[model samples]
Target: MDIGILLLGVAVLIGAVVVSATGGDRKIARLDRRLARVEQKLDAIAANLGVDLPEPELATVKALLAEGKKIQAVRAYREATGADLKEAADAVERLGG
Candidate 1:
């Protein structure tokens, strides 16, 4: 009878932990969505204000640099953000090239 009670307590504890973990995951997912929305709004506002945005998410630029295409990367950055050659080169340099 004592063993049965102990096992039951352990089961309850495990159930509570699982429930808490799943709750945390849901909260994190919700926060991620909110963050993405905010970022989109901010990017739009920045564009209207003629502020150049970073291109860490510019996959093609990253790929170009990775494939030994610094010039192409600079061009891509320029095209994407309407940056000047010097600004584009600086941006590409921050990509570790």
Candidate 2:
């Protein structure tokens, strides 16, 4: 009976941990969506105002591109801009890197 109680307690603890983790993940996803929306709005406002958003100056990315290391340039761009794989690749290509 004691072992059975211990097992039940362990199961409850594990279940609680899983629930907490899932909730945290949902919150993070929601925040990411909100941030993306805000970024888009800001970009639109800047465009309407004829303001060209300054590009991030990443020396490492530029250096890698200059060295003909396209893959490394993409990686560096992603690190610097927090961009995903496709975005980084496109940005690098646009830069003639």
Candidate 3:
């Protein structure tokens, strides 16, 4: 009887620990997602402030490169996104690739 009681106690302890860890993990995940949304909003605000930030969508670059307007595409990317030449070229390559 004593051994059974002890086993039960240990099982309960382990279950509590597992629950606590899971709860903490869920909380962290929620906070991370919340922060991401806030960051996206801040990026939009920065773009509105004339920062010329890059858009998240790559369809425009892909289409431009596919049309063989490489130079115009690169220039448009640089002007609209304010990316350096190397960065703009890399992005274009990746988009087209």
The model with the greater lDDT, 1 or 2, is 2
Q: TM-score of every model?
A: 0.56, 0.63, 0.52
User: Looking at model 2, which ten-residue stretch has the lowest summed lDDT?
Assistant: 53-62
13 Cα displacement, candidate 2 (Å): 0.2
Q: Give the deviation of candidate 2 from the true structure as CA RMSD.
A: 5.2
Candidate 2 residues lying further than 4 Å off, grouped into runs, are: 64-97
lDDT of 3 at 45: 93
- lDDT tens per residue, model 2, 1-97: 9999999999999999999999999999999999999999999999999999677878998899899999999999999899999999999999887
The residue-by-residue lDDT of candidate 3 on 1-97, one tens digit each, is: 9999999999999999999999999999999999999999998998889887555565666678889988778877887678999888887877673
Report how far off residue 19 is in candidate 1 (Å): 0.3
lDDT of 1 by residue, 27-72 (tens): 9999999999999999899999999956445788999999999999
lDDT score, residue 60, model 2? Answer: 90
| lDDT assessment of candidate 3 | 0.83
User: What's the CA error at residue 2 for candidate 2, in Å?
Assistant: 0.9
Residue 30's lDDT within candidate 2 is: 100
Q: Which candidate is the best by lDDT?
A: 2
Candidate 1 lDDT trough over 10 residues, lowest sum? 53-62
